[model samples]
Target chain A: MSTIGEYIASHAEMLEAALIQSLPPQWNVPVSLRESMNYSLMAGGKRLRPILVLAAAEALGGSQAAALPAALAIEMVHTYSLVHDDLPAMDNDDYRRGKLTNHKVYGEAMAILAGDALLTHAFYSITQCHKVHGIPAERVLSITEELAAYAGARGMVGGQAADMLGEQGLTKLEELEYIHLHKTSDLIVFSLRAGAHIAGATTAQLAALTDFGNAIGLAFQIQDDILDIIGDEKKLGKPVKSDEKQQKVTYPYFIGLEASELKVKELTEQAKKALLQGGFANPERLLQLADYLMQRDH
Target chain B: MSTIGEYIASHAEMLEAALIQSLPPQWNVPVSLRESMNYSLMAGGKRLRPILVLAAAEALGGSQAAALPAALAIEMVHTYSLVHDDLPAMDNDDYRRGKLTNHKVYGEAMAILAGDALLTHAFYSITQCHKVHGIPAERVLSITEELAAYAGARGMVGGQAADMLGEQGLTKLEELEYIHLHKTSDLIVFSLRAGAHIAGATTAQLAALTDFGNAIGLAFQIQDDILDIIGDEKKLGKPVKSDEKQQKVTYPYFIGLEASELKVKELTEQAKKALLQGGFANPERLLQLADYLMQRDH
Candidate 1:
């Protein structure tokens, strides 16, 4: 049996190919804008969000081929948020995934446009599920609606706004939790849900996956915070204490590093419990994946 | 019988109400972001795009109610492009429609978030058509796809990118026309197509409307260029000759003013001819709108 690491790596390679296939570099207009979008998109990462999408589909007995577009769309949305968040007006980061950020290589205007293109293209790309994979129009529409909501005003973007507003200082645990829940978890949750939706998971099964998703998503961010303190900079491909440099509040700062690490363990156990309810052909991979994420080093 | 002007006014009023209803002021998380979106959205203008959507639906002998969500979606898209275009990194405008621009009122981060919110909300709004007006899931899906294509990377956003890149100045008339055709006309064309799609227009009829839309939309931009030179500031509700200040390449700047005006007249005639072939319930009204747009000062 393949280990969880191999499962993730295999899925990530498939996702990378799909993403490149989805966005052609040969569009007539927005030539440079398209290149800018490709720049950050092609930059390597774990591809965790998209991997979750495919894994959920497989657990529900769905082929990765059938679920690929939805998976790509979710990743595109994730990528767009990162690009925009790195803008000068936002997080203003200079690097991402061990490379210069989108704005650093492309001009600010082009980076902004690149982000907009990816976000908008996420919608356009998903519509192809009906065309390419013969997914029903109603299902595609439902996905589109859910994607718009989670990624837009009330979810991820709203979380970013709160994070930006609180950058000077956030004292309340609730406020920081809100940021972690919405900014980071919304899309992660969406990716899991979208995969199940493509695989025709029952309402109960979907609920289980959603619960699993939310728990693991929080745990992932907590691990990220933990990494920012104790992680190897070379392995992480970013500065360890950059979050501190930003003067932003974090889980470690609020609850202490030990408590934050404890929270990751708690959330990981909760995710395993949820997946126990999400009955499927082979949920072992998913359960293993949860364990792996909780103990992730980089 | 209501004149074309009265017809437009009636549609605009309904559109205003629908716009307000579609975007509630009460999204709690993105409070300031939602407010920034509402700020420019509620700032009064002619509401031409939504009106055209309704008009095209009516021309196809369909209920305006069926097309209303799409109309509102298009308006949201237009508003988003405006908010972003006015950003500090872009046009850097302080005013829009006689009021402070979103960035000026809400700060740059909020304005950017607002634009992102509005753009995402557009898709969410249109999904309601199936539930609210009994528009079929397939038809709504088609509209969603077209809107995504035209308003996104290949269309409106692409145009905006081209316009920004040419801020130093575009020399060729073709370059200026490319900017005008994509930036200004893409959404307008989408509005016309959306109304037709909702009404189930025949292939020939849809093609004719698209032709008319392309012509009239480009002409609208040309007239806008003329207005920048000769328009009343109080009436237009913004600074005049600001395009010159931005060093933007305008139709009047590329060609002599006389030739530019001549092109508008020619495009207006071509639009009327397209409407002639369109075979609608009241092509006369569309023709009148074309002529009015050609001659409008503001």
Candidate 2:
């Protein structure tokens, strides 16, 4: 088996290729709406969610083909969130991944519709996976249900709502924790578990995977907070200290930088351990992913 | 058997009750976001899409229970579209169904996310149906794929994009027709066809249903255009001449009001004939629905 880094890189490239190819032809959408969707979706990013999906599915002894649709679906959902978040009424950022945000390029209305279109397409993409594999329809349905629960108001959207409201202030560590867990962690956890579920992971395996995802997800967020504080603006490719400027509640804000870093390290280790317990044979990629996430300047 | 109108009304009430009941409790979302979703979904309007699903399923001899989840799924998609449409970036409407539009109440950001969440939840709802019926897993997967296709860009979203662009100006009648067929007709057609698909309708029956749905869908849009010109705002519960004021293109604009009205009558007759050819029993409700659509004050 390839090293985890190599596995992730190769799969990431494949997923990116699929995403680019999967986009509706320019003729398929209005020039304005298509431009908006392509702008954000194709904007350069790490494709982390898709990578997570691929890695988890492979870890569960599933074929990459079996997991490709889910990978695309996760990316679509992620991209949709970013597009909406960039709207004038939301985060109102003009740039993302070092380029103009969807609304900035396509106008707000087209951007809004583009995001809606992408999100609706994500479900369609997942539903089409059954054609690739003769996997039972029940499994597909369960995966769809899980994705919805994790990404909807009860999960990601719920978390985002709290994050927006809590931007004013989060008095308690638990409240901050709740916001991060739902807004950020839930979708990451869903990505991992969904891949495993589609690959038919045993219940025990799924539980372990969920734990691994949760730890990494939190660690990932903490690292983000730390990066926002210390990272170079050019390297990060977006504003630094913007959270502080906005007075957004964050881990480093509440726990201090030293404690936040420690939490990241501990969570990374815990995630590795969980993967090991699951007898995941190709642990090198995920291990590297943990390190890359924590150590990256961006 | 119940008269189709009686069956439709009762089923609509049941579906509405289920929808209200299914909303995430206040505990689940920040009060603001929860209010946004509920505000638009619960706003009084005919539950036409869900009713179509129930009617189609019944027409194919399927139990209403067997089709309820699909019914809910269709409504969610419909509601999501409306929320997105009302965004400042989209149609910028301030009211719908005689109530404040989603963005008007929740602000654009929450409204955008609310729509995203609702669209995501729709897939979840459909998957739950599989759990209830123990339907073949493969069938569930297929149904999900079909539903996604009809609701996503290649269907509804694709149509919407064209509509948005066409509103600026459609150069040709065919271009205008394409926009209305896709934007307005696709989901309506899908709503009618999906229930029958779930019910295991015979190939011939499915074909007939598709024909019936397509005719009605187009007819419905034509009626909408005619109403925009001649209908009373007080009865319609929306601004009657708003489409004209916005310079939005409509069938009436392209074909003239008299021709548009004639086309609607022709298509309505065609729809009824298709239902007859499909051997649809108890189609009284379907006929009444056609009448109601054409004659509706609002």
Write down the lDDT that model 2 would get. Answer: 0.79
lDDT of 2 by residue, A1-298 (tens): 6765566677778887898766546435566666677777789778888888877877777766877888899898889888888777989999987898887777777787788878877877786667767655666777788888889988898888888877779999999888888878888888888788778888877788788888888898888889999988988789999998988878988889999999999999898888777776555666677777777664
Per-residue CA lDDT of model 1 for B47-120, tens digit only, reads: 88888887788788887888888889989988888888888888788888788888888888788888888888
> Stretches of candidate 2 above 4 Å error?
A1-5, A24-27, B1-8, B24-27, B280-284
Q: Pick the DockQ winner.
A: 1
Error of 2 at A267 (Å): 1.0
Q: On a 0 to 100 scale, what is the lDDT of residue A138 in model 1?
A: 80
The residue pairs found clashing in candidate 1 are none
My TM-score estimates for the predictions, one after another, are 0.96, 0.95
Q: Interface Cα RMSD for all candidates?
A: 1.3, 2.0
Q: Considering every candidate listed, which one attains the maximal lDDT?
A: 1
TM-score of chain A of each: 0.96, 0.94
In every candidate, what fraction of the native interface contacts is reproduced? Answer: 0.75, 0.79
